[model samples]
Target: MDGRRPEWRACVLSGAVFAVCMAGTTLPTPLYPLYQDKFGFSELTVTVVYALYAFAVIGVLLLVGNASDAVGRRPVLLCGLGLAALSAVCFLCATGLGWLYAGRLLSGLSAGLFTGAATAYVMELAPEGGASRATFVATAANMGGLGCGPLLSGLLAQYAAWPLYLPFITHIALVAVSAAVLLRLAETVRERQPLRTVRPQRPALPPQVRAVFGPAATASFVGFALFGVFTSVSPAFLTESLHVDDHAVSGLIVALAFFSSTAGQLAVGRVGVRHSLPLGCAGLLAGLALLAGALRWDQMSLLIASALVGGVGQGLAFRGALADVAAASPGHRRAAVISTLFVVAYTGISVPVIGVGLLTGPIGLEGAGLVFIGCMAALVVTAAVYLLRRPEPARV
Candidate 1:
């Protein structure tokens, strides 16, 4: 019992560190408006800046996503923390747009490193037969941390001094404390390897995984795309159309989607993975409809509803997809297959938001948002149909 207690403690401690790193990634969500005002840039610039982080994350996932498996987890995670600190520093010293770009890029790298590695570490830290509960811990830390980012920054930006500087500064301190905690935890990987032996992981799927991967990947894509739109553009919508200027409210609205996603993920345990995907699609479709109504009528209530419902859908679909895909892949190539799914997910986050940014100038934010919703709705409906028609096999 004493031995098991320490393992659980380490598991929880690792999850806390995971949360801290992820919180840094979304820390700037509510601050984008302030950045636009300060830098005299257009809305397109904000979307581009946000997309840059996704792009960087994709790059790292492709390039070195499996580094921790080769080198020790502690080394890779420490490097991620270093990148996060640099990102914070860049934000603190922002003289121009360049600083924001650099900061976001570094933040993306930090997230990329943490996403796969930290998750594996947390799971490994759990006592034997604790895989199921550990999975929830890793996922909650991820979505919960992302949710906390904007909430924390929004409150600090609104109520506290240094709207710009204080949030990142606080994050830096958290990063430091997290690093110390990480150092104290024993390394989980039994066989250590040099960084030079690590190779960039290419996205690959075994022949058997292709069938399930399609619907799974599609659901994952639409789910992340919805988040991309929410995190990148919802605040602008609130400020421009609703004329709601409070940073805390804006942060809470955006954070709602992520927090709701966490809730959706928790439901997967009860809903069963097979049923979760199609049900999640229904939720996403409803959420998109709500967003459309919000956009058309400029109703704040509808917008909030959209965030909550869509977030839950994203959570359910993503977690279900992940669970299904992981079960199907061969153990030898699991990491590579999972990385490919993430590549698709992050692409969803990047491409659609950039498209919205491009269309914003010609059609206005509302029109662009409507267009995005329509496209995503069609995609989610298709995925739902596929899932319903050919339910994912218990094992593909």
Candidate 2:
């Protein structure tokens, strides 16, 4: 085990690298309004652009989710960073809507590769008896890095000159540093195969895992859907409805939701697996209600509260869903099973956000938002009820 300390260090370093790569995905969150102004596009177009990223992520997850396992983590991560660099370049040179769509799609590819590989890599790097703590580190890096992206870009864009170009330029530098850091980390795969060995991954359910998958997936779906709406449209809402136009303020608000989610995920260990799902569902339901109230009242305070409370609920439910599904999955198929759950979670992020975007033309932002809140609330309530009826799974 003496040799494992170095692996642990390598794992932590890799997780940090993963965080930096993922951060690039949201670097444009606070700047969406700026893009809208430059391109003269509607809010619906903004959401469509955002949904494109989710679509790319899902596509990669379905087609090559296990590429890292087969070909080696380092290569996959390096490729992801390369794609991320290209994405930054696209944004830096963006001239039209197509550029934004291409950039988002590239960002999605980077995230898709990192998500599963980085999580497993971190756990593998941990010392004996350190799995649980390592899980937090990996997850925190994932969500926390996502939170930091907009915060960093927004602040830079607001204070520094070249609001559009500077953010991607900064991301390029960070990605370079992250790539260098990743090169020094040890490869977790023992007998890595050739790239040709990679194949499309199919999502399937084993009977044993089906019982927990339902409620856990439900909560995860609603939770991610909440996040989807917040990240995709909240900045627009802040500018249009609340008359708060500061880019930094908008980024900070969105960051708060993701950061709060990290905090909420941390609570799951104490909450226990059984209670985490139901309790998280409760938080999601409350968050949806708060969001609906915000839309109805047109209050900035309500938006902030919805972000904080709803984000916490999302974090709780998301982590719980992952844990529940992972525990129930057979060892051999664990990665595949987990990928399926993520597909479900990410589906939540895409479909509903697009629905809102589609509805924006007919009903307006407030009306569309209210409709989203109602649907998500119903889903969360359903999940909570299911949790209540079924016996809680045995905790690890």
Candidate 3:
């Protein structure tokens, strides 16, 4: 969205709307075990159901990823919000595994639409001189919203009446309010094109960008993979192995990672871009080791430590990698390259998560998680070494 001036209030409201939609994507994080019981499915099935959302998100990214740029942000965002509401309804009325699968896919579609468009919309709505602060608002909204999902739902499920039903119902109300707020906002695209003209353009990376992309993308991939494991299987681990069955606690543990990630990202300004990547890798390594300890000892404290450390690592490396990659990309190909990077990072969430699922049946959850940590640790170590050997120049 890029157009005539609107109150900066509109920008913040748009960020809030973005937050609401993103929240729906992860609302079920703490409730997955419940779904498993209801459907009489194994942990492997639960992971598969969760991975379906990521796969759907990837599909949407490949197909209609840029549709908002042509058709206008409001149209796309509204549609996204609508899909989010439908996803919630699917959950509210879930009768079996099919409903769960459908809900996840729809949620993924909503997220794929909102990810780029909402960020751009939030930026476009910013008033003069408010760009930096507005960027923070948008960034925090994305991560903060993800953090809030489990916290809100977990509390409601644990303490309130009707565990599964209330969360989606509350979210549906929020989506309604968001749609109203969205309608009042000004249209950002001044010269919007027809949706028909928006095609799936293949992502291209110039040679120079490829050099930067490899290690930078690795940081993002590993970070996202860590999160994927936490969101999909950690609750099961907590309940079954760690002997912690409280929904609120589970939600908070999951939420901590996303919240810590925000802190990690904010730290980048002080840590310096060059330091952030390697430092991030170090944090990730620490987090991984902590996770291994958590699994081996079945210690709640160790698990919490892993979340906080891993989150910081993810935020630091991912943000720094993005900055360096953007700096290296030719101006004309910058957006495409960034999009390509995101696709790879998101794949880390899906592919590794499903792999854990497959391994859960044979090796067990803790063993599968250890395998995941070992693999991601290797990737993060490689990235760290590369960054140390050849630091990204301060200029570019």
Off by over 4 Å in 2: 1-8, 394-396
- Give the top-scoring candidate (lDDT): 1
Give the TM-score comparing model 1 with the true structure, all chains together. Answer: 0.96
Q: Model 1: which residue pairs collide?
A: none
Question: For residues 1-396, could you state the per-residue lDDT of candidate 3 as single tens digits?
Answer: 254245577888999999999899889999988887888999988888888988887777777776776788899999999999999999999999999999999998998888767766786688876655565566668777888999899999999999999999999999999999999988887778888888786656777877777887889899889989999999999989977779999999999998988788888878977898899999999999999999988999999999999999988887777767766766444434556776777798899999999999999988999999899999999989998898555333
lDDT of 2 at 335: 57
TM-score of each: 0.96, 0.95, 0.92
List candidate 1 stretches off by more than 4 Å. 1-3, 330-332, 391-396
Consecutive 10-residue window with the lowest summed lDDT within model 2: 330-339
Lowest-scoring 10 consecutive residues by lDDT in candidate 1? 330-339
RMSD in order of candidates: 1.7, 1.9, 3.0
lDDT of 2 by residue, 170-199 (tens): 989999999999888777788878999888
Candidate 3, residue 53: Cα displacement in angstroms equals: 0.7
Per-residue lDDT of candidate 1, residues 1-396 (tens digit) = 887999999999999999999999999999999999999999999999999999998999899887887787899899999999999999999989999999999999998888878877887898998866677787778888999999999999999999999999999999999999999999988877888988987777788788789998999889888888999998898888889889999899988999999899999999988899999999999999999999999999999999999999988898888777766877545555776788898899999999999999999999999999999999999999989999447574
- lDDT at 118 for candidate 2? 74
lDDT of each: 0.89, 0.84, 0.85
Q: What local lDDT score does residue 245 receive in model 3, on the 0 to 100 scale?
A: 79
